[model samples]
Target: MERVEPMTLFGYEKLQAEVKNLKEVKRPRVVKDIEEALEHGDLKENAEYHAAKENQRIIDSRLAELATFLGCAKIVDPSELDHVKVSFGSTIIMTDVKTDEVFSYTIVGGSESNPDKGLISFGSPLAKQLLGKEEGDEVVIALPNSKKTFEIDEVKYQEIVFECD
Candidate 1:
């Protein structure tokens, strides 16, 4: 059985949008490309046909993946989260014990992790260490390179809003 994973509302909406685009726009475009390529070709040496087929395969794979993801996704409402302890969808601020560098990260599901944007997967080392920890709690996290200590400064849950493109 596939485990149902928690996803923020924004993440769920994003996945839905991607699925729509793939089915509506990309699928037809690839089909057209394949048809046009078929008209020009000897099957064995048709580069355009081969390329279109490969693209179709990729789109089909992604569509299946997205379908599975959406099927098992549970959208988490930020307003329902407890602010006292860190958990999935919690935005946390922590200060490094050694360098005193402070950083903020939103703990999200694995599918929505974007380190560059300060979104960390709930299963990540740092998020795992922070889970169930409260503000002012000190914790140590071991990374691939080194072990670092941090003091939890704050934990809050805020609704994530994604701008439609």
Candidate 2:
């Protein structure tokens, strides 16, 4: 299996929990539902039985995907980050020159990003642009319409310890 890039401890735990839930709780429940539906008679005309079986297949597929990710996961702690240069688990403050808007974002792992919560993935265009930049540095990012310039107001290494899925 290919290794997952920069997995957090929290992310690993969440994935494990999801796998457990799917296997222990969901899988059995689905099996029981399918069994009950099968008791209703001919499966050829049984929508409930087919639907339950389909749901089980989906759940099993998701479980397999999660297992693969977990098998390849290597948990990394943010406190281990030493490079001051922009990288994963860094909080960056920047000012958009064109809009004169200031914002702060925490660069996180790809699996942990919640854009609405101000956590951006390192793979994001903005994060890519900010990478390797320091405070007072300026970077121009190519947007869909036009290039946007941003001035780095601050760069701080953050050891992210709290996460929710």
Candidate 3:
């Protein structure tokens, strides 16, 4: 099996908390719902019972997944972040010379990506192109549709806090 790289301590904690919620709150709630449905009679025709059982399966699966991720997690520190250029957890600002469009994105691990909120994964095309680049540098990136060019307007080291809530 491929080894899972370490996540930030905060990220690891979030996984653990989710697992705890699944086991402590969700599982019990599902069990109660199943019992109530079963009391209603005929198991084969009981839609509520079936639905509750399905939900339980999903919750249990997620709990197992989170536990596995936590077991393999390696906490990476902010102090160890690369400062000379764009890297994971670094906020980068860039401009499209062709369109005069300016945008800023923070490079993060795959699990933390939320592009709509401007938090991009390091594995993303933009992040891959931005890595090792300094301010004022121009880079051309190949996209599935076409090629685009960007100029690095600013490069700075920024701390990232992954909050669970």
Candidate 4:
């Protein structure tokens, strides 16, 4: 089955930018490096040539991966969606019932998710349980090691910031 990738506009644009950079900047530089290395002599012992070829292979691979991601991308803009109920792109604020610790997370695409930055992928365990939950609802999530319960404090739409400030 073909996987449908649900990505925010930011994520999509980021992928596009990476592709552009690889093609326009990185690819040409590697090509030039390889050409220059070719003049240095025998291919059997040319480390520079080998290194440049390896770099070219890596760049090409990344470009192909980016192409697949872009091809399957379904750009989603949270600003246009309703925030009354939990769903993709919703920034959820919750309090851990057991520890009484509060945490906030924004549900995003797999490519956009950075748990350290509070961006959780919609496919994750926590996001799956939070999908249709509303404010004031209690949620129980099954983690790999243990189970944790949380009370939903708020659900709102905020522009996703993929990078840390």
Q: By lDDT, who's the top model here?
A: 4
Clashing pairs in 1: none
TM for candidate 3 is: 0.86
Report lDDT per candidate: 0.88, 0.83, 0.80, 0.91
RMSD of each candidate relative to the true structure: 1.5, 2.0, 2.1, 1.8
Candidate 1 vs candidate 2: the lDDT winner is 1
Steric clash count of candidate 2: 0
How many clashing pairs per prediction, in order? 0, 0, 1, 0
> Which stretches of candidate 2 lie above 4 Å from their native place?
159-165
Tens-digit lDDT track for model 2 on 78-150? Answer: 6678647777778888899989999888887776778887888877987888888988888997989989898
Most accurate candidate by TM-score: 1
lDDT of 3 by residue, 44-145 (tens): 999999999999999988987777777766677645876568866678888988999998888766666779878887778878888889888998978899
Better of 1 and 4 by lDDT: 4
Write one digit per residue (lDDT tens) for candidate 1, span 19-38.
99999999999999999999
In the predicted model 4, the residue pairs found to clash are none
Q: Tell me the lDDT of model 1 at 55.
A: 99
Q: Kindly report which residue pairs in candidate 2 clash with one another.
A: none
